[model samples]
Target: MLFRQLEYFVALARERHFARAAAACYVSQPALSEAIRKLEHELGVPLVRRGRTFEGLTPEGERLVLWARRILADRDALEHEVRALRTGLTGELRIGVIPAASATVTQLTDPFCTEHPLVRIRVETSLRSRDIVDRIRRFELDAGIIYADGVDTDGLTSTPLYQERHVLVAGSELLAGSTAAISWAEALDLRMCLLPKGMRGRQLIDDALATRGLVAAPQLESDSVATLLEHARTGRWACIVPRPWVSTLGPTAEVRVFDLVDPVVTAHIALVTTAAEPASVLTTALTGTARETDFATVDRRQR
Candidate 1:
């Protein structure tokens, strides 16, 4: 019945291993098991399928996990509200961002930090668009930045932040003085290092090329933008990247950027947050900043 027990159960459910869950909860295996046992006794229902090793949660445990997450989230929100009244916004804001939107995350984070200097910001860029939505639903993230297309937005509020314009990036040596835009068909003819097929950005590229009666066969596939950009920097391969990524690259002396033409495919990037009643204060601030961010102005300034 204790809050710690609920936390322990939630950790156990997520980790799916008694030892690992205990480690995550900063407790010993025996202590965690005892706590779960006490929780089950108090609730009068077996939450887990007990065995020598970690077994999946029981049907009841599945339901309890949802309730546990909401309870913990509500408790944190209450604390944040009280602290805000006394000390301004103070707490951690966890954001899950798709790699394509990685560079533009600062648009929201920077403003949020400036307004609420006490809040800590954490941006995780290793998630897919779907994974970002899933985390928001689970209350594991305050908000996320992801592509607006084909994402599950149920129970979430989405605000369009900017349009992602595709661009071709290559080593300056490879491109020489050629700065003209290239068609998708022309770009595919080069030795390309691109994001893997599993990523949404890669999928969009493939679909666009498919419409042009072409298939992308990348010379190298990577999930990391840095990795692809590094390959392009070697002067052996060209990569397609989003315009927002230019800001993150700092100085692009090694690579020349060209806008992609001949069927320009621009996708909208949105700030997504849970639409749960009484949204978290952090999510509110983030979405507000997203709404106010003038991407056109930011792009002009950055240029």
Candidate 2:
């Protein structure tokens, strides 16, 4: 029943290992286990399945974890609000963002921090767009920057931030200059390296290519954008990336960036948050700044 016990339960559920969960909670293994036992006794339902080691949570535990997370989140929000009233807006604002939208988070934070310099910002990058939505729904993230397409927005609201235009980046061998734009078909024939098919960016590219009845056969598949760009720098392979991500690199003489045409597929990136009213002070600030700020103005100068 205690908040500390719920915290331990949630940590255990997340870690899926008792020792590691205890370590994360800064408590000994036995202490964490005993706390969970007490929690289960108070609730009159077994939260965890017993075994030799840390087994998975029961169905009831899974449901309880969700409620526990919401309770903790509300508790934190109350603290943040009271503290903000005493001083100013001051708390950690956690943002989950996909890899392509990672560089664009500063567009929201820069203006937000200027208004409330006391707030701390943390951005988790390279997440699947769907995962970002899930985490926000669970209150694990204050907000997220994700693609608007193909994401479940049932309990959430989105504010459009910017449009992501696909581009092809290649070394000198494949593309000699940055002057010309190439079709998705032309780009696919070359030796290419790209993100995995599971990523939102890759899915967008694949969907666009499918319209032309083509499939991607990458020379290399990587989760990191830096890796793809590194290969492209060698002038041996070409990669597809977002235009804004390319813009963050400024002038890249080692690589050529060409716009993708012949059905230019664009995805709108938005700031997504839970639709619950009376958002935490930090999220309110972020959502407010995102609404008023112009992405082009903030992003164009980011480089």
Model 1 misplaced regions, further than 4 Å: 177-179, 301-303
- Candidate 2: tens digits of C-alpha lDDT, residues 37-76: 9999999999999899988999999999999999999899
Q: If scored against the real structure, what TM-score would every candidate get?
A: 0.95, 0.92
The true-versus-predicted C-alpha distance at residue 176 of model 2, in Å, is: 3.6
- lDDT (CA) per prediction: 0.85, 0.86
What are the per-residue Cα lDDT tens digits for candidate 1 across 1-303?
488999999999989999999999899999999999999999999999988898899999999999999999988988898888898889999999999878777777888799889999999997998999998888888888889999779889999888887788887777675656778877887899899988989988888888889999887899988788788877778999887676666676787777777778788888898888787887787777777888766556444
lDDT of 1 at 274: 85
| RMSD (Cα, Å) of model 2 | 2.1
Among these predictions, the greatest TM-score belongs to 1
| lDDT of model 1, residue 109 | 87
Model 2 misses residue 196 by how many Å? 1.5
